[model samples]
Target: MDHISREVDRTQELAGVMSKIEMNHRAFCFANVKDAKFPLVGGLYNSLERFGDALGHNGPEPFTHADFDGRIEAAKAEPIQPLTVDSGLTKENVITGDAINLHDLPVPTFFELDSGPFITGAIGVTRDPGSGELNIGIYRTLIIDRNHFVINASSMSDLRRIYSSWEATGETMPIAIALGVPPAMLIGGSCKLPPNMCEFGVAGALAGEPIQLVKCEDSDLLAPADAEIVIEGTVNFSNRVENLLGEFAGQYGPEDAPVTQVNTITHRNDAMFYSIVAGRHPEHNTLGNVAVYGVQRSIAASIREVAPEVIDLEVLLEPAMGTLAHVVVSIDKHSDAQPRDIIERIFAASGNIFPVSKITKRIIVVDDDIDVHDPVDVRWAVWNRAATETKFMVIPGIESWELERAAKAGQKSVRIGIDATMDLEDIDKLLRPIIPGIDEINLEDYLD
Candidate 1:
């Protein structure tokens, strides 16, 4: 990680530096944040290698199908431990009441059109009012003032449901936002886990140990004890504000959320305020890929249930598509109609973690020979192997992702399915060109 000593503004200047860092897929620290007490860190999870390194996997694949299943199993095996009140989170300072000012923390306004500076990296901690279950998730928080902000929780998020339950009680919900938590914790928090599963437990599974938690100063909710900064707050459903922040889909997402009142701010003596550069950046997209842990696997399982011949699946996080993911499935095709059957079943399958019909808009089915992970090969199969008349299928009026910009009224959108596999009659003719000993050849040895 490189450290830039030059003082930077909390406005677009900080975000500008972050953009430059992201362009090179590098991690950076703004050592001197103008008008703030601490430095700002960005691009920590900017690449798959970096993200994988954080989780102790030193290779290209950060999250694999096996890893996803392991994480699910680990969460079931290890439950969240009880909270420990004493930790390094408040080693030096704990500001309360008038002393708590969010502006002093170097929160960055990543885009010019943003509603205000947003805390993009913090994990929100809340408790289920009825079940007494704890939940942790990453939600963009728009800073309203020195002591207030609005948390944007999506409709499908557990936090939103918890918010609704709290609202029904006509009481303020105690919430805590933790910044600079462990990488595993951050990844786990981003996953859309089952209602009864604890995110801390999932994080522990990823870390191969229990995650230490500390009780919040003003709330019963627990946050990572090793967090760099913690903001304790309470929110009521009375006030709602509509805001905007650039999202991972490379577009500005509209947000309508409840305003939260900050009660206390705690941090270490020398703290680095972490911020994920909002919108279409490497870190934003890489971190957002944590959805593969929950949604992608669920979709794959649903597809397998309907099409047992399916061999591989890849739910691509195309940055420009927002939440409408593009899916690629490779199948062991015995008949030409199998591809269409697989595609239709996938689009209609009722997903577990998320609705497959709502999230997936485009699906492509290729033969077992095709590499589902390779975009070029998938495109080649789509163009070269698929027939014009019957290979393409479009079903109108399907459910759309809520954040989809192109969706019609009533949140409706069209579903497209492509049978990129070769026709059963032309399978021999459509076989890909392959060179003998291509994998065994060492061009570098001969050239040198």
Candidate 2:
């Protein structure tokens, strides 16, 4: 299946399935989890708690975005996006101790190195203190204790900005953390969106319906209809520190960050828990690419309006860093219209997306003859087709993302351009080699 079908199938998989709590308790967290692309959810899930079915496929299986977008549409087709509540979730919702109980549900410890039981895929919904807009992000929640979850709103993120505003007024930020949301919602909320756009709206675009949201028991925000578990609470303004947890970056961080006070715990009676494993691949790295396609498609559409024959785009996420870096465009541009001009325009438009590691050092502009995703072939193009000295262009001092490379103070990067195409002189006659005997004799016949 492609990106569209894969996304649809994901929603169908979640449709009416028991809440994530049941999925986790029965399939993973409570079991012996392992680490592999297709390990049993038990072993794979414990180590790879970010998404439920995490697997990888070679041979151009399909863009994972197809799965994200397809499922979103499948979900919107459902009659109702129901909101189920939970017990041991939250009571009245506080930024500190929940007079309510939290020990009632089954939370899992992902990796042994983790601080404790971490909330792997919690969709943290907080009211933007500045704009009063709803914001949903996948914030890793650390269980500091029974009643406390360490909110690692690093001073660098917008979450910290919202938390600061609430702190100044001597009030805690109301929060609702939902789990087991449809796969598309997870992909949409995984990154920092535009200040004016909500993740749910993006989910809607991918899913093809207005994301049906339900009001949280203790707050005024809305969550997905199919979320399996939810913890409604608030961020304690006074509690500035809590335990830090391990992240996908393979580093332990934010040793002490803001903490959330549980107030109420609400869910379906047999609620299941869900967590995306931090290090696993296929699912581990593909979620961001799904969102990138949406952004890429939007950008490509605008560019295609100006320049047609743009064939394909490839987005690579740095497993350890650089969440937003991209290598895009395999167009069939055949004019002096300038590939560098169009390529540079793409980088300039939405390049500094919030926490990208780096813009591609080489923005390889190719002839339709090249396949960008295949490394061996791309290399062949660079050597046999593109002449690097004349084709490569560099733009120095452009920061693709400011949040990227914080450890380096004066870091400046140069973008690259590679023209991988058959020279116009030979374009009309070039042909791939074909074996002489393939159509005349079958290998299977000789084997027999």
Candidate 1 regions off by >4 Å?
57-76, 79-83, 320-322, 332-336, 433-448
Best by TM-score: 1
lDDT of 1 by residue, 1-448 (tens): 8889988888998888889888898888888889998889888988766766777876555656456446555655765553465765554578997888898888999898999999999999999998999998999999999999999899768998999999998877999999988888888888777786788888887787788887778877787778899999989688999999988777788989899999999898777899999998988887777765567667778887876778988887577655677899998888877888888888888887657889888999998889999999899999999767799998999878778877899989999999998888997888878998999998998995
| lDDT tens readout by residue for model 2, 1-448 | 0011121111213221212333343333332222211111222222223332432223344535455445444433442222233422222222334445554443445544666656666778888766787777777677766677876664334576777778887866788888777655775676555574566665555544556676676777666655666777778766666554544444544456667877766564444556555433334444544445444445445545544556876654454534334464677767634666666665555333332224344456666657777767777776776554666666666554333343234655556666666666666565556677777896787795
* lDDT of the structure predicted as candidate 1: 0.83
Worst 10 residues of 2 by lDDT: 1-10
Question: How does each model score on lDDT?
Answer: 0.83, 0.54
